[model samples]
Target: MATFQKGILGGFSGKVGNVVGARWRGKNVMRSLPQRGSYTATAKQEEQRLKFKTVIGFLSPLVDILNRYFGSPQGDKSRANLATSYHLKNAVVNLPTGTVMDYAKVLISKGDLRGIDGGTVAAAAAQTLNFGWQDNSGQGKATATDELMVVVYAPELNLFYTNVAVATRDATTASVTLPNFMASLEVEVWASFSKPETNFAAISTYMGAVTVL
Candidate 1:
């Protein structure tokens, strides 16, 4: 039986050789198999090819959308409220007697008077009259006899007020009458130097104002 099986296998090998010799060299042997419609790639290779194509297609549309949404955009940040600074300048003390009494200048910077609550006299004390008063004799003196009266004018409010006096006696006098000079918002200061019969010459001078931004 072993010999018979060996003989049969040898005959099969010979038959395969004969079929191959009937065809031309290098011709596809697979073409003789029954046709199963069409050839298709394995599942893994097909999935990999699909992923590669998807990646390539995504790039152009992604760039176009980003450019349309974010490129060369306009901004309205210029309309914001701006920081500003102001200082007192050349304040002239116009006495009721028609005489321009004295002139003084004020220096104002942001940090000089920090944490001052708005709309109060003490809040604005950092900007005060620089000394040297003009007396009734028209002499510039370093000191005044009574108090210094200042007339404040606020340009933004278009108003003027009178008798915002700085007392010479008390360095810390912090109260004053709110002036009713103008309907517009403004600030003015004045000092009183004498009582009736006091021969202390009335002085007037300019108190300066300034602003910084």
Candidate 2:
């Protein structure tokens, strides 16, 4: 009976060992199955985050460069002072009564005054003046007879209206003769009408070459 009992005990132990081994192998196989979908999602999210960061980094530098070129903060005032000329063919004309006058085309030219040489003026001093003088009852007809004043400013030399001229009337056209400003210098122009018109128009003038010392 003792021998029988010993054999039975050995058999039961063997069966238990086999069952445990099989369950362990099955658990490992399940664990090994691909988690590819989860991995792909994670990778995509990381890529998008990196791309967004890169774009933001590039834009930050670009904005800084633009600000520098455009003279932001303290630089703007200094840069404005250095500008050669602030061309003003499209300048708004204000009347004494606080009403805005309509602008017509105006032109400007640079060179020495007629018969004068060696000195130059801004080039192409020509523009048109537009105005309507008549009220609803035809009381006033638009007139181009009023003299137009051309004033020029040069910041480099601290000059104001160093060169001035008047526009000549030609029917509906008006033109001013400009003298060669100091060579190689930037200059600003301003215009005023002797009388105001009811309407305004666009005008342009060419700047003259600056002489370099």
Candidate 3:
């Protein structure tokens, strides 16, 4: 019977009569306290939470990088939030009976119909990294320009190198120059097709992580 307008900083705790206040999605809300006791989630629920964390850890660092090029289809938030939400939900849920979701692959594709295939990475000159991939745009979809995202982390040094490159749809390779190279580097590569008109990018293909010599 009561609807409040926006523009209020929300913080609510304890209980006021029959109504309890809480903050949700950056907004203040009131609801009746539940009668149930606290309980732990099941094994399957925990597994899904772990999946969400894994997906989030990988994508959080890439938010700035994604926003620079892909922006967002929704506009209100960065594309990274969209990618995270999509994959977190994707980790759970049953498919159409016969279908099975590949969480590993889903982490990279992130729900985009077009994904990279046969991607390979190698150390290119002194501080440059080379990446190559095959287009996985099944049928009917016209081949569009592709964008490449490369993230390199040196565990020993606790360093990260992030870079993005653009390639023609027909081109299968691109390279990025790092600020400096370590003896051994762990790298994760992703690629997505660009919809220039909409300023949106398709789901990215995770090119797998590799240690380069």
Per-residue lDDT of model 2, residues 46-138, tens digit only: 544544443333223223222222222344453222111211212223344532212222122221112111212333423221221111111
Q: What TM-score does candidate 2 reach?
A: 0.25
TM-score against native, each model: 0.24, 0.25, 0.57
lDDT of 3 by residue, 41-68 (tens): 9977876766676666555666665554
Clashes of each: 41, 40, 0
What is candidate 2's CA lDDT for residue 49? 52
Determine the backbone clash count of candidate 2. 40
Off by over 4 Å in 2: 1-141, 162-165, 169-181, 195-213
Better of 1 and 3 by lDDT: 3
TM-score of 3: 0.57
Q: Is candidate 1 or candidate 3 better by TM-score?
A: 3
Cα lDDT of candidate 1 equals 0.31
The most accurate candidate by TM-score is 3
Candidates in order: C-alpha RMSD to true structure: 36.6, 28.8, 7.3
